[model samples]
Target: MSFFAGNISYNTKLDFKTISNPAAFYLTNLEADLDKNKIVILDNSHAFAFKVPGDIFKTVKLPKDNWLSFSYSLNFRWDRSNTYWHSNFFLYLKRANRFFPVIEPILKKNGVPDDMKYLCVAESGFTHAVSPAGASGFWQFMKGTAENYGLKINEEVDERYHIQKSTEAACRYLKDLYKSYGSWALVAAAYNMGQGGLDKQLKVQKVNNYYDLMLNDETARYVFRILAIKIIFEHPRQYGFNFLPRQLYTRIPVDEIKVDTTITDLAGFALDMGINYKILRIFNPWIRQNQLTVNQDQPVILSVPKEGYREMEKLSGAFEYTLSADTTL
Candidate 1:
């Protein structure tokens, strides 16, 4: 198959031996021009073309009263068009499938708007990431804020890395923000830039609306970034992200084990549980060290594969002995 662009003709044959770089070849030749005005003919029998839709922005939902003007459009297009941003957005979409099931319920139970989950996508890309400013987790809660929102943060454990607990803390924090601002848009802005900064901006600008108030560059673009993520996530194919169901990440099913006692050797404990140290930490990233110190009053819950421990043990072939589930050391 051959396609013509201007006067240049390119063959779309999948001959790997002839093509030195398959990726570059496909990107340079096979991808559509995306030009609104010109249509390229493929061979002599088939032709196809697409243009940017007239009501593209209107098709995706945004908050009715909030700004969806030029600023929002710019951010949306940047997210859709920039190669780096587009790849990350595709990854965020795949990760969302693994996380939203865990996050959305917490948002709903706390009365936060369902759309607010995208704020998390904006915050940390649904990963347990720690910002240089000390914000951590999928919700990106800082140390003091995470503590204030009832997340346990300390040397041995940081619930900021715990998805469910951190999401709960986020819901609490978001509810408080909503109480103060009475607008989800402002709540999002406040979430990005501290409540104090946003308050100062509102007071200085004498404007209650997020769109009306001027903020620092990061804070100014924060909500719009979130809105863009929401739009792209809702309509991924429209923004050029395509994936099969199997290509996306998924939540692993696990059994929660309650521990009220300390374990001195986490690696040994993992082997005793018929798994490995890496798998244990993968499921429980909040475990900061090789040892877990527990108090009887506040037991820590650990997640393990529900029915695959034996399979994992066989696959690993490294365990010499297996202890009872009640073993804490």
Candidate 2:
């Protein structure tokens, strides 16, 4: 028998540095005797290593004694799809630098994991104005659903576009979903599909784990999309999405002006404040009409965009704001 198993003995040069960070380490002298064709042993210890291919180890053999039993906990329990993982991960990381801040508070307030924020990226692509299948806004609340979630929607105002209001409404809806499912993953999945749909599938499939169940392509990819987003969002720089301070979206400045009376013309009111009607709607999306006809005299707060536009206008003394002539119309 030639050197262990071969008909002929052959020696190969070993590059010690190439095996950096392998699961096992071999001494220089012992490495010379290591059989390249067979698995090597390592000194036994209760330690984990980032396994790398092709490295010799000095393994230790520990006696089986008093191994404590522990309860099984599920850290990440989902069937990972290769295709979704790659695509969604890239998208999540691409928008993560901007989307994270806006979504974090909603999760914190709702008692959901902050990781769920990536679902927003998967839903709206970090755009507040995305409209897919008639779903609207950053949270993608549909008209009927938005109304159900306590978001006001009408011809003049759509609160779905307001970040804080929409997020709060989304949290309320999510809390309800969680109360129904008791699992964040299931809640997220149900958020994509309705509670009725998810419940029907759960009963039909006779399984609860999201990954194991066969679903419609969109629903199947849903949880994977969320997980991929969580992965990339958690480690943005690891995936080559780095941005400078100035490149990210900054919060706009505005002052809240509460109105308890009728506004005959919002365009005029906006102009009186030295701003445009477009800017007025841009800041206060809750204002649903070009003219606020207050029949009930309920005080509605309007946020007027400040800083660059307002401050300059204030300095120039271009316009001044006054209460509408008719308090009720």
TM-score of each: 0.75, 0.63
Candidate 1, residues 171-210, lDDT tens digits: the string is 9998999999898889999999899988998988898887
Candidate with maximal lDDT: 1
CA-lDDT, candidates in order: 0.69, 0.56
Give the per-residue lDDT digits (tens) of candidate 2, residues 1-329.
Answer: 00122132223333444533111212343234443443333444222221111211122111233112100101121223223244444443444444466677777977766656667767876555445466777788888899999888765567787777888888888889888877777888888887888999999999875645567877766765565444434333323233233333444556878788888899899889888776676565556568866555567778886757565434243222222221221
Candidate 1 regions exceeding 4 Å error are 1-83, 309-329
Q: What is the Cα-based TM-score of model 2?
A: 0.63
* C-alpha RMSD values across all candidates: 10.6, 16.4
- Judging by TM-score against the true structure, name the best candidate: 1
